[model samples]
Target chain A: MEEVWVTGAGMTRIGRRSEPLPELMAEAALAALAMAGLERPEAIVVAAMNPEEFVGDGNFASNVASHMGFADVPTLRVETATSSGAAAFYTGFAEVASGLCSTVLVVGGEKMTHIATPRVSELIGRSIDPYERSYGATMPALAALITRALMARHGVGEREIAAVAVKNHAHAARNPLAHFPTPVSMDEVMASRMVSDPLRLLHCCPISDGAAAVVLSDTRGPVRVAGVGQGTDTLALRHRHDLTSFRATQTAARAAFTMAGFGPARVDFAELHDAFAPFELIALEDIGLVPPGKSGTITLDGETALDGRLPINPSGGLKARGHPLAATGLAQIVECVWQLVGRAEGRQLNARVALAHSIGGLATNNWVTLLEASR
Target chain B: MIPTTVAGIGEIVSYTTLHSAPEGFRSPLHIALVQLQGGARFVCHGAQTRRVRIGSLVAIEAVDNIYYFSSLNALDRARLFWGRAGRAGDRVNAMTRSVVRRLFKGGESGPN
Candidate 1:
């Protein structure tokens, strides 16, 4: 199999926009094509979690392809809840690596702001089991529960959780495309209204509209997808043995690192699924970058910041970059490629290898991709 | 929307406690996966519990006009299961009957 390299990546500013979903997706795709120096791609894969819910449109991949002027190209859609982008990207990579297509375009987008906040919650809540929905258990509720468990089990304080948000927002302030670019102090995060007990409003990622696109080619280049791993667990959290840790994330990250022939220590930077502030800590430990229960300590010690030894979430992460569900994973990958190529403006780090972590439906489906700059 | 009573109680499959909530929700909520007595499963959220052991018979209670099987209500155990059919009408009836028959025939002896 030929090596797959990300030749180009682009994304629109993640926030509420009057523009339609197809337009946003087209903008991102065109930007990626421009970056790749290609007029069109051989194939396209679109990832959209719920265009029906977000934009009242089905056949989203074809619709997006049409808008991008790739109507006749082989097109397909990939959906795995929030990790749909990463899943689609993986599919495109396989297509190119297996000689099916020399170049493939993978794009993800969502228009979540089209609906009311309550309806958005209801739609997102459907990701959980129906029985859980009947009990008013939504994604945020699950994250809150996990945060509580992590705090109690690992002795992670509220301040440490706030620090995660503060750091991500501070980094996002430098990102022009960030949804919430204003840097907030730890006190502000702590004082923010409580969404759930321990989890404040600032701890959770915002609901935004955005799209991201990446061009993958068989041609070797500065960055190659060294490894990719995908794993899934029961959607119902109750079936799992633990709440504080993401079993699927651990399995996926381990597989990815093994496939990449490297460990977490070799990664100069990482983009983890920080849908919730506490999740960063949980994911850090699950991904084997930090020892169990030590993520909170590392954050408190400023070890995951931009200037830290292992910079994490330099694109502000889902916390500040805005999590448009399916678009989030691809957005993370875009940031990784930028950092790897030293194109990330303010948050660039001295890193050759980067990792992108995405969680689908409260870690029910997890994907981890490792990218390295070719020597 | 529908009025349902606590009929039979089952074991606790798993549970988690939330110290914080997401954007719009406030207060800590505890979510649990409870296997009802008749093979029906449900995910419930409620007040925190210090001890949530498996096999504890919990009572279904109503809060905020929502009916949920809450933590163990020791005092209502006898009344909760009394006069309540094993299955929620018929669909679950066949499933539960077959499950019980298989359990006994399979050499698994226990109170139904």
Candidate 2:
């Protein structure tokens, strides 16, 4: 089996931008191509959540290829809702590891800031069950529903959930490209407008427009794709057997750890989805990064801080860093790559192993990627 | 999947109130996941009720393809009826559903 490595990573500022979808994606693609020092990749794996609805573009792979001067190269798009970028990484990694493609360019982008916030919420709601969407269950509404479940079931408190936003913002303050970099205080986080009960505005990630890219090859480098796994579950939250635990994340994390020949205890750092601050806690528990019902409370003790023992979401996470839909998953990998190679300037930490996890559609589909600094 | 039936009373697994309802729905719509007496859990509309606490005994009454819940023992209080709570509900946009179906899939899902 061929070992996969991340040779280069590129990301654009996450916010409302005037650039078209193709142009935004092209910028990231070129940056990654140059960084990887490759003229032509064996294949291209592009990802976007709702280009057709948001930007009125559908043939994303072909347009991105043409814009990047790789029109004739083989290309395809991956869509797994919000986790599209992570799924693309999974696909690109397999292409390289299978030896079918020695080099693969994985790019993901989303231009969401241009649309009205409510419209964007509707677009995001499209990812929910139609039955539930009819009830006006936006991402935050659904997240609030789950957050309520965690609070009721595991004794999670609102203060602990507020702590997630506070800590992530403190970390984002150092990330130059983060959209909401200002470190907000716990009082501010708690006082913010309540979008959904128990989930204030501060706990939610901004709707961002941006792109991120990563180049994968079958050559040894500082960042090796030790393992990647994907998991799927029932789309509707009600259909699932459990509300607090995302079976998808658990399944994906288990597969990733098994493939890497390690366990959660070995992970030095992590970049899990924090689109909703409370989700960070749930994801940590589901991925086995922490024991059940502990991710939330331990967070108050500086356990998951940038300088803490686990350092989950050192890149500001989706809460403060901004979630650009498909770009979020790939950006997570980019952050890991930077951290592994000692280039994460402001939030840099000494670590050889990093984990990136992404969730799509209320934890319906999930991906877990393990990156190592070396063999 | 085997077919099963759920009783009217159960406990609240989790709940949420949506203040920003879409075009077809009214704001401040309350929704919840309820565990039926028979062990089958599902989400339903919470109506005519203020402050539906978790782990409380809730009664359900079905109407118009939507089910509503009340934390009170409505069964005992005789408060259990298809009472009107106005437009605030998971009121399906018939037009939107068809259009969404055409735009995405025959019968598509929200979270991918």
- Candidate 2 TM-score versus the reference: 0.90
Cα error of candidate 2 at position A163, Å? 0.8
What's the residue-level lDDT of A258 in candidate 2? 89
DockQ of candidate 1, scored on C-alphas against the true complex (2 decimals):
0.14
Taking the tens digit of each residue's C-alpha lDDT, what string does model 2 give over A1-375?
Answer: 799999988898887789998888888888887878888898999999989999998898998999988988999999999999999999999899889999999999999888888888888988899877776677888898888877765447888888999999999898988888899999999899888787889989999999999999998766899889888998887787677778999999999998999999889999989998888988889889899878877999889999899998888999888899999999999999999999899999999999999999889999999999984
DockQ, each predicted model: 0.14, 0.23
Report every candidate's CA lDDT.
Answer: 0.81, 0.83
Candidate 2: residue A244 lDDT (0-100): 74
Model 2 Cα shift for residue A334 (angstroms): 0.1
Candidate 2 chain A least-lDDT 10 residues: A147-156
Residue-level lDDT of model 1, residues A110-225, one tens digit each, is: 99886888788778877887756666677877777567657655348898899999999988998999999989999899999877555788999999999999999988766899
Candidate 2 recovers what fraction of true contacts? 0.49
RMSD of each: 7.4, 9.2
* Reproduced native contacts, each prediction: 0.22, 0.49
